[model samples]
Target chain A: MDTAAQPDTAPAENLSAKVYADLKMKLIVGQLRPAETLSIRTLAEEYGVSAMPVREALRQLASEDSLIGAAKKAYRVPDLTPSEAANLFFIRAILEGAAAEIAAENVRAKDIKFLEKLVQDMDTAWQNQDAVQFLLVNFKFHSRIYSLTGNSALQSMIESLYARTGPWLAHGITELVTIDSWMGDHPAIIGALRNRDAALARKLVEEDARWGVDLYRARS
Target chain B: MDTAAQPDTAPAENLSAKVYADLKMKLIVGQLRPAETLSIRTLAEEYGVSAMPVREALRQLASEDSLIGAAKKAYRVPDLTPSEAANLFFIRAILEGAAAEIAAENVRAKDIKFLEKLVQDMDTAWQNQDAVQFLLVNFKFHSRIYSLTGNSALQSMIESLYARTGPWLAHGITELVTIDSWMGDHPAIIGALRNRDAALARKLVEEDARWGVDLYRARS
Candidate 1:
């Protein structure tokens, strides 16, 4: 399990928000392992907070399906069956594809340049064998494109879908290094975005999402 | 604003779950109004529970985007702007369309019969001018089709999307009576499902979801 860093003291009312954000970030970064039991006391002790905030945070994550409430006072990160993982990836494909098509209609030169930089950064992360940086850049890359559509609801839904798959991706970061073909598709997606080709961009984005499923299946 | 019915006494350990479930149902049934402020103390009193469970339940709903936290210790049902609601509906079209496509592949004869019965019930509700029953059957009809896909994650995602629109639907029930064109699309969806045509099912489901947006737009 990846340990959480202690956060600075926040005002009393904001403690739960602070804890929830920190815990969600940890889950997104793959710092937490799936099926790992999360004890309120343990999390509180680690974060130097009291149990109340931790309890609230756990409930919030549980609502998002980021954590499963196994029993009274027991919460654990959910372990995705291969099929669940595939289903999520399929949904992401549909959503991200739609997002890309919308974004293409709105993409400006600056947006294309920003995406180009992200793809460049991802290549650098890949060359350095920095899985964490690669994952962060990769997430931002897609997120940036999704944001171009200016649809908060769609973007948030996509983020939530990413959160569902984040732990599994974190657990299998090493597998990403070996899956050279997986990252190979991003350049074409970038090209489609650069060319403002809505159809091609949508198709490539969907293909990229499927590649993510392929990576997960290979690792599992 | 629609007032919530008082819940029966729940064990201390399950109070939060009970409150969450009750609140969600109210939203689903349109008992809660959009942009209605939710006070913890008031809800605690109404449910005959403590502030703790109410607080937790509100946080859970906030995470689901069912309620928006506006300030410290204050939450409200989100009032969708026209575009925001349109975006959600578009995403629903994509998601429910994919669900229908998958369901078409896995649908059994009995599932077809069950869906046909739901369509029949919806017609009866419409004829009786019972908007509440129409809404309930409408929800169940789509829900039943989505479930045939046997994808829990997809089903849950679809349900959450429904939650986002439920309060608005509830608030606009009377408007449904004025919109005869809205329910006219269901029979075609049922026909596509009966034929077990994945592509047609997907297209009709997407069109059906758009009809929901049309209804909302008309009411707004």
Candidate 2:
């Protein structure tokens, strides 16, 4: 008997979707290595589910360009050549830079306070070397900033890009924990926004982003 | 037979997606009236498809936000409330205006000639009052300009926003077709860019977009 055909024995219908989401998260968080081949059947077996959901999940991930799929074939984590990685970085810089600028004029006092709390939380997570907590808080921090514009479309665009870049968030936070001055930039960014200094806030955010690229280059 | 189980085979899906795409094209070209609620099952049956596809198609349309899903889950053509419309206009002006400035330095001579040919095509489309053709060419015109940036991310961002504001595209183009002076702006924009005047090109593009919003409002 094919164990993969079993449906009600597990949440099989939704399992693929969940698996896809998990892998996508791991990819963005850098848990999964690039060019890693993830087998559908193996994943289904490991998760104690059927392959149908896994298939659908992979399809959606492929749509986001998180996974490479040969037509009518298997899937694997995409490996970017140096040039492709550079292109992605440049695009991220321009888009995120613009988003941060737009966000500066619209962020509220409460959001600033929330960000301050986020930094405090990150500090705790960093000291403890708690990767999961750091990642979650970082996601919240950026989402909150993106939400300031109240443009769902903008938020979705950012989310899609973040999804494609998978697993970079955790790596970013880990880097932050290592460099003492790194975390200082966030507060400065928030301060500029709080003061209604749009240009200054935008400059700070871009500078912060530039620093991250430099760090990534040094590390990677 | 309930016919609900095999919803995939039902014609609603076929009809609805077709209607959705058709209506979307019309809206994007300014042929369909805004504030319209295209009937659901009626359209499904009319198109010889089942309601499932229609329902899914409408939901998909909502995903791109070309159509708004409202109270009680009815899908309707989106109407740009004054403030929301203003916000959309300004965002486009800021983003696309910036894009033109960026593209000016990089735009090739061959691309400018292609743009001139596009303008001539628009003249023919305008003469025929071919709203669809005009819209198609208009899309090509702006897209060709957008392509000059060689930034997929930025192009994608602008396209996403453009899709969301599909209704405005149709309305804006239709009105521009009536006023001959509207089409003249494109050449002047190309002229400014050819002169390598990034600032002039940027200003012209900004003015052109603002002029569109004004024309759209005048129609209302």
Candidate 3:
């Protein structure tokens, strides 16, 4: 008799998942800021799709801590507290330092060549003020080193951590008109790897990462 | 008129999610073996729910790589390929080893006491042949150490890795029955913490993990 009161009616199929993906990419690329509220309907109309996929994508992003979901509230991008930021940097230092060490120990000649080429690509992109291409090449360069560690899980965990920091790092890249000195660090890191000096490689990566974090914080 | 051929006319809000959670816990506890598959309808009936939750749960589990899913096909538990296992252990060694170091520096006297008591609880459960309780306490004990690290991201990554190996570890625990030796390792780890020797603490944790991995592999 009370079947009409059922609250678990099935949800409609989502059509806005594409919007969600695009929005997520934008968020990761610093096109959106922390605490930004992405209105579902606005996105749906803009993407020319219904709101369902957007809602689903938002749910998944919330699980990744990229978005915050609260009771009776629309989702918003997560804000990093000072303490969380400090802790994130600590975790990154350990994992990335270890990654650099492993990569140097196992870096093949081919991998080093790829990294050098990628760094060159970064310089070209920097001159062109092509933020998107610069960001893409930067990701590939770091990832090539990580994958050389030959530890898929470590590679994955590092990637996840980096993805969470994408917005900050992307912003840093965009504001820097010419990253000549920053680009200089890449070759030094690669040179250390080529010399098979694991410790030196690790140090360079940690220094590079620390410098990036500091620069981003100061800019913010 | 041709929309009938489209997949997912709408998102299904079903009870399969609850089924998935229940099954996942059992799988983590070693009730399910690698390559095992259960009929969806059968599991639904056994869990006293409709098939929807089971479907949703399987999809979620598949995303975690704990279960393998194919569209309109039966889901199967993923086998722990040797390389995958090795990769998981490697990441765990790094993260948990660092956690022990952090825990040693940060854990309170009361936390040490709490850990010691949990070790005793492990002894009691092992004596009573209560495999379930033994597993539960062991998980809690390690989790307590992670909490002491105070890095939520590190803790979360470590737990996901733990879950991936849950079934295998449970089987190892049941057959190996070297509970005393395993429980014995915790005190040495705690002792290092008590002394605030972070390096020593990290070393002990790494040794403790290596021992477990060795045991698990021997059984295999």
Per-candidate DockQ values are 0.63, 0.15, 0.24
- For TM-score, candidate 2 versus 3, the one ahead is 3
**Order of candidates by lDDT, top first?**
1, 3, 2
DockQ of model 3, rounded to 2 decimals = 0.24
Expressed as tens digits, the lDDT of each residue in A1-220 for candidate 3 is 1111111212323333344445555654455666777676676566666665555556545544667766457778666775665677677778888889988889889998999999999889878887656666776787789888888667756665655665666666676654566777889999999999999988888777676566556665
Per-residue lDDT of B132-155 in model 1, one digit per residue for the tens?
Answer: 566667878888889988877777
lDDT of 1: 0.78
Candidate of highest DockQ? 1
The lowest-lDDT stretch of 10 consecutive residues in candidate 3 chain A is A1-10
TM-score: which is higher, 1 or 2?
1
Residue B136 of candidate 2: its Cα lDDT? 64
Q: What value does DockQ give for candidate 1?
A: 0.63
Q: How many residue pairs clash in each candidate?
A: 0, 18, 8
Indicate the residue-level lDDT of B167 in model 3: 67
Q: Is candidate 1 or candidate 2 better by DockQ?
A: 1
TM-score for candidate 2: 0.73
Per-residue alpha-carbon lDDT of candidate 2 for residues B1-220, written as tens digits (9 for 90 to 100): 1121112222222344355555445555555557777666876776677875566556545545667775456677778776566656665676677778888999899989998998999889889987667766766677788778776656655664555565666666655545776787889988987888999888888787676567667777
Residue range B76-111, candidate 3, lDDT tens digits: 876776667766777777888999988988989899
In model 1, which regions exceed 4 Å deviation?
A1-13, A175-177, B1-13
**Fnat measured on candidate 1:** 0.79
